[model samples]
Target: MKFAVDPWDPTYGTSLGTELGESAAQVALDVELPSSEWQPIDPDPWVVPPDAVLFVDGVRRVDAQVWVDDGGAEAAPALCASYAAGVVCCCKDGAHLLTADVRRGLFTTADAADDVRTTAGTYRATRTAPHPDVAPAQLLSLALQRELADTELAAAAAARGGHDSVHGGADDLLVIDGPLRGRQHLPRAIGFVKSHRSDYLPPQLGGVVAALRTGQRTPVFRLGSSWERHTWYLRLPCRPGAPWAGVVRVECSADLSAGEAVGHAARSQATLPRFASTEYKDSRAPQNLYPIAGLERELRRRLGEPNLLYRALRRAAAA
Candidate 1:
């Protein structure tokens, strides 16, 4: 037997986890092609990419974990997180940042908790009610993510509206760097998932994903979780290694027809590979496209220094 290393840096975790569990989402594999005909589809060289490609990403940092002094017998645990979202637009002229927004929040279920105003930044109090199904920390994290998602949507809208003057009336493609759960309503938008945690496809179709070569993609399929979306798998350019190296899942809103989803899938083949990052430049290369990497760095910078923010929070608490 032969073993191959996954190109993703170990610190970030493997691109594909070993504990592949079946997805709870209802999956329809025949949206674009019959299961019997499943195989990697080569990119259509003739399909021209959109005139402009917008890359949207968000970064969040937990500045500190604190205990809320609510009037209850015991204090409630809360998290102070700083999150920022941004968009980078790539067109015939060049790639440049379009919009970026930063937000800070105190997430807790304590009814008495108020907005946190520190010297560094003000974290608006976000009430995240406890869920029996989820942990408190995870609930706080999810609340932070929801704020980030909203910021991302705003950034995307601002970018699109602000750039039309510079890029003319040319068509654009919106690429969200993670799952498209909340942002699926955006037009011409596709979710760019860099890694996999669940096995959404059956073993027969999973073989198709493993067999994909650079610049190739699997046929579009539908995934229904809490929300529904059409998705496909594409292999980005990367050094030969793991069977799933450079693989990423691309998805679009289920509101689109199957043919339209297929069109987006084909257009992705012509578009995304151009921005694929090399291992030398990115720890999550290929999957983490260049524009997205730069946007993430910028967003994190906008989030401010974590240590400074933490100290500010501590000082505020002391006062």
Candidate 2:
């Protein structure tokens, strides 16, 4: 088969370099960046309570059609539909014992017909119904899936119980797969960031982050954004080359006092590395914890037979 390919000219490399250089320069604008000073902490200082921690993650897939029409002469909108699913896994004695709950749903752009308009910095109001075509529908589908997944985790956190109480504290930790975002306020919850966007520290400090040894973590530092949190980087045991080869960022609510924040940091340094996946088990091993990888597989499996679901959606639209 003949394929057209975009030619890589000399200008391409220069353009790419300029973009990356600007990105690195932009890091300085993040006033919340941590100081260059930091110290390494040992992971052995803490003990994880049995069956008191939960890990949450989600998965989604979209099925679309080119041209869809109602049963009669009525015009049919393009169908962009998907299944969004999430799972909550409870940890016990350094192992994920069982799935506490599974949440999933089928969503489509057609359902956005009655959505009201709103003006917000982060939210763009959809005044008109979404187009049935793949592009428009798929965008709406993805947004819906993300919302559902976050909602599921929030519900599970509520049911599992909060971190501590005045009468007696609940010794549970909620480890979310990605940034806590809107869910940061959840009690005893923390966000696990697998990918790094920009440097959150100066070069010298970042060097310390890169040099972190297995089971070692950087000193906890406060990060301010639209939300506030204490953040640190930890290294997992893995075959490594670069400084950040096995490093991952962990974030906890800044609402905690200094002592409490340090305690949570210690618990994470000890608990997370134990769940790190081997290179043979995952392409993104070490950073992608084994329990999270397993939970992702389980959620995708619960999405059901894709072909069957696709045909059902088509049949329903036709009818």
Tell me, by TM-score, which candidate is best: 1
- Pairs that collide in candidate 1 are none
Model 1 per-residue lDDT at 120: 93
RMSD of 2: 9.3
Off by over 4 Å in 2: 1-36, 44-51, 65-80, 84-142, 162-170
**Mind giving the per-residue lDDT tens digits that candidate 2 earns over 274-319?**
7788867776776778878887787677666667766655564464
Task: Provide the TM-score for each candidate, comma-separated.
Answer: 0.96, 0.71
- For residue 258, give model 1's deviation from the true position in Å: 1.4
Q: Tens-digit lDDT track for model 1 on 30-81? A: 9998999998999997898998999999889988999998898999889999
| CA shift of 85, model 1, Å | 0.2
Worst 10 residues of 2 by lDDT: 115-124
Q: What's model 1's TM-score? A: 0.96
The count of backbone overlaps in candidate 1 is: 0
Give candidate 1's error at residue 165 in angstroms: 4.7
